[model samples]
Structures are given as C-alpha cells and as structure tokens.
Target: MDMKKYEVGESILFDIGQKILEAHWQDLLANTSLRFEKVLDVVTVHQQKQGIQNVRPKNLAPKAQQAYFQTGAGQTQHLITDFFTDSTKIYQQLKALDSILVRNLGPEQIIWPFSNRPQDLLADEPSVPPNEAAQLGVRLVLSDELLTQLFTTETAKQYPSFAAFKNAIYLHLAQNIISNLDILVYFFGAAPIAMPEASGVKRSAIQAKRFLNCNMFQDFDSYLLSLRKAASEPQPKLLQAPLFLRPQKGDLDYRQGVQYLDLQVLDIQPNVADGVFDYQVQFLKLFLLFNVVHTTDPEKLTTAAQRFYQVANEDPTQPSQARPRVTAYLQEMREFATKFFPKTDYQTALDKMTQVVANETQAPTAQLALEFAQSGLFQFGQQLAAKNQRILTGEPYQLRGYTDKSLEIQQFIGSAIELGLNYRFLDGTGEFLQLRSQQQSAIINARITAKNPLILQAILADQQAMNNLLGFAQVAVPKGFVATDLTVAKSLFHAEFEKSGVVIAPQNGPKTAQQVFTTPIDEHTFTTSFLEALDYDDTVVVKAFIPGSVYDFYILDQRILAILEQVPVNVVGDGQSDIESLIDQKNDDDRRGRLGQRPLVTIPKTAATAAFLAQHQQNYQTIPDRGEQVFLSAIADLAAGGDSFDVYEEVDQSYQKLVLRIAQTLNMQQGHVAMIIPNIYAPYQPQPNSAIVTDVAAAVSIIPYSFPFAGNQRKLSQVIIQSLFSNSAKERADD
Candidate 1:
C-alpha cells in the first residue's frame, strides 16, 4: 500500500460535472425497462471490491479484450472513456483515492483532507489537480449475442429515436456513481462544498424550508415526478454541491475565492488494523442507503442519516455507547419502511435482515434470539454472565449450541438469563432447561417455574380452586362453578348464559382462549356436545363472561410487579377506507408480526374476524365512519391477535393494593393473575360485579413488559432477578 502526498485542488467545475454524470446515471437506472433483479445484481456488484475486478477490461478474456478495444464514443459504442487518458491513469487515480484512508483527520466533523494530500500544507494554498477525485472507467465487452439483444430495433421504438435507445444501452456500463459519491461524503473524508453565505444552522433551516415547499413524495423518483405535477411551486435549489477532500488549511483561500464549508480535523482516530473500521463503514453505508431508498421524505431521510452518523461517529472505540442509539434508529427505520414500502420492491430490504443476525443457525429460533438481542433484554443476560463467569451457550450471545429449543423454552432461557440465573440442560437431548443459582434451582420444561416448583401443579390444574381460595380471603374473584361433565356444565351455565354469555374451559390443564367455549344459553348445548364428543372428561370451569378489557398482573415475591392491559385486535376507521383496507394498513406495522417474530402478533383477518364483524352488523368491506374502532376478535389473547399496553402505573394504586392482597391469598412468589375490568385506570371498589378475576397461573411471562408493543417498557426481568437473588442471599445468611 504505497502512498504519496500531493497538493490537491478543489475543482468546482469538475465536481459539478461529476454530480451531473452520477445524476444522469441514477435517472437512467430508475427508468430502465431492464429486469430489477439484474439491476439489483449490478448495484450489489458495485458495492464490492471483487465487483470492481470483474468490470475491468484487462481482467476479461483476450477475446473480450478485443471487443472492448474496438468500442468507440459513438451512438453504437458501449464504453465510457471521455475523462480518462488511459487505463494506467485510471489505476493512478483510484490508487490515489484509496489513500484517503490514510488521512489523519484530528476531529471527525464534516470534512477531511484527501489522504494523498501533504500532511503539512500552508494556510493559503493554491488549487492544483485533485488527488481524491473518484473516477470509474470501463470498456464494455461487446459480444455478438449481447449486441443483438441490446441493440434490437424493436427496443429503439420504445424511445424517441434510435440514438436515445442506444444511449440507454450505453448507460448500463455506467456504475451507480451517485452511491459511490455518497460513500465518499459519508464514509470517506469528502466534505460537501456549501454556498457562499450558507453554513451550519442557517443552511439547515433554509434547506428545511425548501423541503417543506416540495410535495411529500415517497421516494426520489416520486420527488422528481412531483416536480412536474406541481409546476406552480417555485423550484428549490439543491441543498449542497458534492465536493471531495483537497489540500488546504483551516481557512478557505484555496476555494478560488468562493466560500465553502470550513474543514475540521478528525480528532478521534480508529484502529483500522483488523479492517473493523472498513467493515463498519461499509455496513453503515449500505444500511443508510437502504433507508434512503425507501424513506418517504427527503428532509426526514437527511435527518435520520445524519443522526445515525452522529451516533456511529460519536465514540468509535466504545461501540456499546452507540448500541442503544443504533437500536432505537433501526426500530424507527423498520416502522418507516414497513409503513411506506409494505409492497414495494425495496421491502425486501427488511427480509435481508437475516444477514445481520450473524449467528442465526435456525430461522425460527434465531429470529426470536435476534428480537430479544435487539430489545435490550440480552444486555441484562450479557452483563450478568460477565459478572458471574457462567457460560451462556448460544451463538452470538452464547445461550446454546443449537436451535432446537421450543419457542417457549427459548423465551424462558432469555428470561432466566436476564434474571442472572445460569441454566443447564438436564439431559443430552436438551429437552429440559434447569434454571439455578448457588442456593436454589428450578426446572423449566414446557412451563416456566418460580423459586418454588411444588405449588405449580396445584396452581395449573385447578383455576376454580385458586379462585375459591381468593374469594375466601375476601379478594375479588370471578363468580364461577366447576362442572364435572357436559350435564353439569349445561346446568351451571343454562341460566347465566341467557343474560350474559358463559365461558367453559377444561379445569385440569392450562387453558387458552382458543380452547375455551363462549356461548349464549341457547348455544350452550352445541358447546357442551362438542366437548363431550372430544372425550373431555375433566371438570370444566363455567364462569359468566366478564364484559371488559383483560389485564394481567404479574406478582413477583408477593407483590404486583407490573400490570399489562390487553384489548382484542382492532382497527380504527378513516372516512375513506374500508375495514379490510384499514386492517391491511394496521398489519403493516412491523411490531404486529407473527408470533415469535415480533413483540405483538398481527391482527388476523380470518373467518373468525368475518363472523365477529357480522355480529356487529359489519363486514370486511364495511366502511365505518371516521374515528370508529372495529374489533376483529372477541378475546384479548396476544397469540389470537390482541394489543397490550403497560398499565402498571396507569392503574389506580388502590387496585394495585387489592392485587397484592390477591397475590398473598394465592401465596405466589411468581404468578400471573388476569382480571376482566371495565376500566383499570379507575379506582377499585368492592362492588360484587366490578372486576372479575378470570385466570391465575403460577408461571408468569415478563415479555409483555420487557418488550411491550405499546406504552412504557418495564424491566420485569431485572426486578425478578434482583428479588430472587436477594431471597437467596437472605437464606444463605440465615444458614
């Protein structure tokens, strides 16, 4: 990597010409009729070093070289050779450009001297040949087959003239130079040349004003289209001219008397020995460009890009500082991409996130791992592991060697890790995970456990018994009866179901809303018959359907840690769109994805939804009035398409106190108590039918609070870990 210093000049005319060339190439690519897959391949190639090699004429076969040399700068020619004198000059220019890597910019701001510029130059220097100018030169290897395919007369008719068609064919040889120029401005040390009086806040404000005048287009091509449609609006000036690094001091004497952005020295230097900086720069460039290509507004895109750059460049050595910021940026970026380009070609960019997963061995499990890792939950596990010297066996974050763990077990692992509890596979098959500390341990199979596992069986098998105990303690519990058979179930619910619907579910196992039957008294016979036909002999709990939203109170160490309120999956209507269209738009939210893919499950539009809508005198095509909310499901089960909100603080403190009393009655160290209440935000009262405790379980999930779909995120994992650790410490002291 030989390098030489040169007195580089800032060539304004050359810079303008370069920008025009890049813009022209961009327009050509955007409007071309060529297959996008081929175009994507070409764009991808331009981003790689190897791609450069493939495009060089000398690297091609001798026969191909002959075709390249025969091409001329004409309508039929397919080569770019206007600026370069020869191939040797091309190599010299590129080699000099790469030297920008060596520049010792003291403080990273918005500019740097060309890497080839002399380290020590005078304050007032004159302009000379630019050393950091990027030049892309190539000779197209024309084959008989390629010529026939590209130069077809039929293709010529699509354009205004044969010359226009030939120009389009020739443009294929032009690399995506605008992307390269952006790389220089962002990754390399090129500083943008500013207008005479425009710099800093004034410049930004002016640009923002101009941006507001422009129509809010979805992308660059759309922005171009808007210019033609809204011809009445005054045309806005381009924000800044593209400029490369040059040899100059702090002042602007070398700018040919034109004022430009003042260059600053790069203050912080990075260790580039391992190519880490290079990799980061490349990834950041691609990531930002993907957003830029998909983002709806130019002003927003610029702000986001600059914000990302600030986060990355703030402290390169301590990347952990940037992790949280980067995570926030990516989350916003995901929402933006999902909302704006749900069905566009660029939407595939979101699909390509697997490449970033880095350690994803299996698609399903790795995806879950990736979600927790990004949500900041893994940070708790990582910090704990580092403090305890325990081995966490997964890849990337070291949780396991394989991905065969059930989704439930995977979630438990994440929770256990966050709680600072080390886990061991009880058997070689990895079917069971044992979460333990020095003083206590618990086994988690399909169901997660608390510090005490003995009470789990009784708690899971009989919700009716738990409710009876809660009621005996004078705690608010749902009024229900246990039915041992179909006859008993019908007898218990026959009267109540006529006034309000009754819910019947198995009493001998953990129940899901899907497994429960909710029907009116007239419909009770059908449900009772269906359960009997399935050979369900276990007693079923028959309870009057509580009319309200459901809230799950997480009790840890005999106290209410958090409360999560869930509502049936629903959409609000705008005046113009049908319910079906509204659902599509709502489902476009990235957070509302399939189970295990995101924090929230997507609202399903199925037969059940159609039936539910029909019950409300509506259908999928029904266009409800503005500001109307239409629910698609009857139950507030996340897996069945429901939204959750953190109501831990929102719930009245009196209700919180009552929940603690209920926790005490259950004697739960860790448990979940679900209640159906009309309004959690209102203060609790001892009314006979105010709130009904729907279900209680010994095992509790922290995910609802850990990565909440809406409202403030709660750190339940940390709280659980600290509490359990304290309990273990107290027991050790007693010993």
Candidate 2:
C-alpha cells in the first residue's frame, strides 16, 4: 500500500502497566506514606525471590493469564501486551491484563483510583531513593522498523545511503521527542508529589521529570554511546531517561540501528483500565508525522522541551510562559494532525487536549485531589479503581460528547423526542432535519433545495419589500434613505452629521466594517465605504450611527426565545502577567480556535490590536494594573473575535414584549431581531434618546444565543421544537 494513502502507520507498541498496593484486598491502606516500606518490601521480594514463572499463583485457572510483575518499588507493574496498533486492540489487551490482575490480587490493591498521578501513591510514604521508585508508570514504545520505513519512504530519494537515512530519521525523532516532552508530560505526567521532599523539585501535577531524564543527544552516535556507557560502566543507580533510542544489543558495534523509542512519560490514569486511550494513539501518530516534516534547531528544540516541561508540570491547561516559537510549534502540530488525519476520533482527541489546556480544573489529578482532599488516600484510590472498572465495563458514569455542538444538539433532540414530536433528517448529510406533529411542522436549516419559485423570489428579490413592511408597522429603524450613488451617500452623511453620526452599510446584503463605517464622517471616508458597499449591493443604506450595544433576540412564532449582548473581545489583567501573556491565555481557551466550533473567535495580534495598544500607550510587555480591562479590537461581532453574553434573564421583561411586537410587525415568526440598546441589561431604556433596529435575518447563527459565555444557556432549537408542538396541540384543542 502507498504510504501517502495511509496516514497512520501500523503496529505502534505500548508497554502499559498498573501500579498496585501490596496489601491484601481487605486491608485499607489509608496512608501511602506510612505503607511505602511495606509496599517496597513486597515488590523487592517479588523481584528478587520469585522468578517470573513462580510469581503466578498455582490455584489460578488456566484461562487467567499472569502478566503482573514487581518494579524496583514494591508496587505491582503488569506488563500488558506490546502488540497494540489501535484503540480497540489496546482496550482488549487492557481488559485481559485487568482480568489476570483481578484473579490474582483482586481489585482493591490498585493505588490511583481517579488519577494517573504517582503523588497519590507516595504522598504519605517515606522518601525512597529515586532509582528505587523509577519505572512505576506506563511507557509507550514506538516500533523502530515502522519509523524507519516511514522516514525512508518519505525522503528516500533525497538521501542515498541507508546510514544517512537512518541518521536523519534519528535526528528528526530526537528533535520531535525533545520538543514535545512537555506536552507528553501534560497528557501523561502522574507524579505530582515526591515522598519526603526532594529539594529544588516542587510538588507538581506532572511528575515525569522526577524519574524520566530528559537529556537529549546531539546525534544517533552520541545516543548509542551513552547507552553503551551506561551498560558497561556500573552506575550507582539505573538511568532515569524517560526517552531514549533503545539499541538492539548491549555493545555499540552490534547496534545496527535504533531499536525503538521508549516513551516513559505517560501517566497511567488510575480509572482507565488501559493506561492509554485510542485518541491518544492517534495524536501520537500525528505528532510524530508533524515532527518528521518540520525541522528545527537543536537548541530551540531543547529550550521548547524544557519550557513545556515546566509549563506542563505547573499547569498544562493554561497558556505557558514559553516563547512564541514553542507556542507556534504546538499550534502547527495540532493543525497538521487535524488536517492529515481528518478523523472524528482524532478531532475528538484534539478537542480533549484543548479542553485540558484551557481549563486546569478539568485535569483528572486536580479533580481527584479536590474531591478526595479530606478523604484518606486508600479510600480515594478505592473509589477511583471502582470508577475505572465501571468505565472499562462500558457502564456509563459521566455524560461525554464529541464536542459542545454535539452535546447541545443531543440535548435538543432528546427534549424534542420526549414531547411526542417526530424528528427526521431531511437529507443524508444530517445537517438538515425536520420536526413534525399532527398540526404543525418545522424544518431546520430551511434552505431552497427543491425550490418553490415564490420562496426563492422572496429571498432573492424582496428585501426592499421586507424593509417597507417593517416601516409601515411604525417600527423604529435607522433614520436614513437608501442611496444608489456614492455621491448621494456623501450628501446623506453631511445631512445626518448634526443630528447623529452617519453609518454607511450595504442595503440588501451582509457587509463587514471594511465596507461599513460609523463616523466623524468626511467625504473621502463616505465615498470609500459607499463604493465598497455598492460592490455588494446596488443600493447602500447610509444611516445614523446609533451608539449602543448590539442585542440579538431570537424569535420563535412571535415569542422571544433568547437575548444576547455582544461584547468586543477584551482581557482583564492580573497584576502579574503582561498584556501579551493575558492575550495568549485568553486565546488558549478551548472556545477560541480555528474551527467555528467555538463561540468566541481567537484574538490574533493583528494590526488592529497593535493600533489599540499604541493608542493606550501599551506594548505587549506592558503589565496592566490589577482590574484594568483592555479591549483588543473595536469589532463587536462573534466572527470578529467578540464574545456574547446571555441577557435574557437580566433584561427587563418589557423588552421581550417589545421584541415580540417588532417580530409580529415584520410577520417574522421565525427569525432574529438585532437592535442597538444603550444598556443590554436594560434593553427597553435608551441613553441616546433613540434606539434603532439595525438588521433582521430570517436565518441566524443560533450558536452564540444558545451557548453564550456568560449567563444561562438557552435551548433555542428545543424551544422552536416545543413551540411547534404547542401550536399543534392548540390547533387540536380548537378543533
């Protein structure tokens, strides 16, 4: 098979294990600190006294396999199979390993119940030597053969010799590993605490640095030399490198090529029976692929690795203090993965990583610690084990969805179905769906597919008629006339200047601020904006610029379903971090990304931001005083990096009645009404003496209204469905 056609390589090896307490099933080993010596004794004896064969209990059934072994520490480490290629197989292997462990040790001996952190195990334990405590976590070893094949296939023609190809591959892999070690730790680091205190090493949520030495070799030769030296010259302790090029032999001369990349940084999540998830495997594959293609300086790679390690250990969920190069590298990697793989599973994994990076509270270790802070370690461990077991057995514990969109959509569908409404997909694409009852029916994404000529004509040609109808109803609209010529727009701006600031926008189409302006209007500015607007529409509506907040009210059958207040993208400063750091932190939010899956857009450091900074006499490095809020841009649309807050509950009840009246006047049973309000919370009141209805859309982007960053989450779709059902019931009652 062509390598290019297959994005994912085959048969990556996984060496995952569980660390269990040595006490009996009934023994409540409440304090890991006090029980460390006993645990160590059990593991030491298991390793020294019992050989692999003798370790298996004699009374165990033949079907029950024994994969458990003792690490240097007393904890039991089960070497689950090395033949994992995908999630399903890895899950099967984990299940098998779990069955064996349960048969032998029972379930309660496992240490981490809800987390992958080693701190839970060693927290109260006496400080053991570092070497003795090594290898207690899970390791993922990628196949050298597969990696070599990938490298040669992609760049074989460029490099003639096999040694050159191998060397290049080694260098690339080294760079990739070094650069991503911090990220690896973020996802897998479990040792947050060290027993008794290791000076200079603080208690971190990520403990990979404790055992895994992150020293990177300059080349393959140096890597092999270090390994050979470690084997030959007796070191006082075992080498603690988390990542290294495993050699095929004991000597350097016999080392033909690198054997495998041993990745020992991943923490075994206590509740996950398999230490790894399928999505994680997909991410790793993409990570490797990205590194192979993108080259970087070794020094930069090292710096990034160190920086990431620090950030991941401290708080992997937030924006790091790493340099722009390091941050860009991660963003590039994620983009590359999402682009090449393009699988829902891969996207889901990426989403999870985003969530982790955005919200520190989402980390399993943080959650477990918070939940079990007062509970004994043993009880915490037990609860975690039970939770993991439940997950492994396919018992639903927490409600998880692919993304926020899917989660909200699922809720809508579930609610609609419960109300005796029939729902069906209008197309195979699943994007368009219909809800029906005996007397009424409503279509979502109601587009002209099998077009009715009248509907098409109304949408494409009757915008002027809609405006005239709104005008006839005595509705408050922008006080301006439509201009067919740029010269006319200039005159209108001058005529309206004394009364209100003039605004120029396309009359019958969507227009961005680039082609729309609110002024301090001059003839030149008016002409430029009017000409741009004319390109989109024959006529331009030059109106009075009403200074107010933009409020969007979703209307369903003359009833107001939801209201949202649009606020331009801005950041509140802490006394510590600079403006740039805060912006980076805000953009790191999972809700701000390249995909429109989020509500708020990413505030890029564009020319607009620079201008704003300059106007405020602030640079990226400027540390704002505590409680100072800085606006990033003037644009206040969600697409323009603005955020929306739900104001339905806060806004006066009279605003809902007013919006309903407006919707009824327009005869728009299902549409959105956007108006300018001086205060969003007090929508019925206007400070500028007049409020203007800016625009109306038959179809609107409902996402912002449904999932506003602040205030109550409104189920507009569900409300629409409910209204249809209600209308149907009312019609039946009349009959």
lDDT, candidates in the order shown:
0.43, 0.51
**Superposition TM-score, candidate 1 onto the true structure:** 0.45
Instruction: Write the residue-wise lDDT of candidate 1 on 536-591 in tens digits.
Output: 53666666666687888888876787789988778898888999999888888755
TM-score of each: 0.45, 0.43
- The lDDT leader among the candidates is 2
Query: How many pairs of residues in model 2 come into backbone collision?
Result: 7
Worst 10 residues of 1 by lDDT: 35-44
Q: After superposition, which runs of candidate 1 have C-alpha atoms over 4 Å from their true positions?
A: 1-424, 427-447, 508-519, 523-537
C-alpha-based local distance difference test score of model 1: 0.43
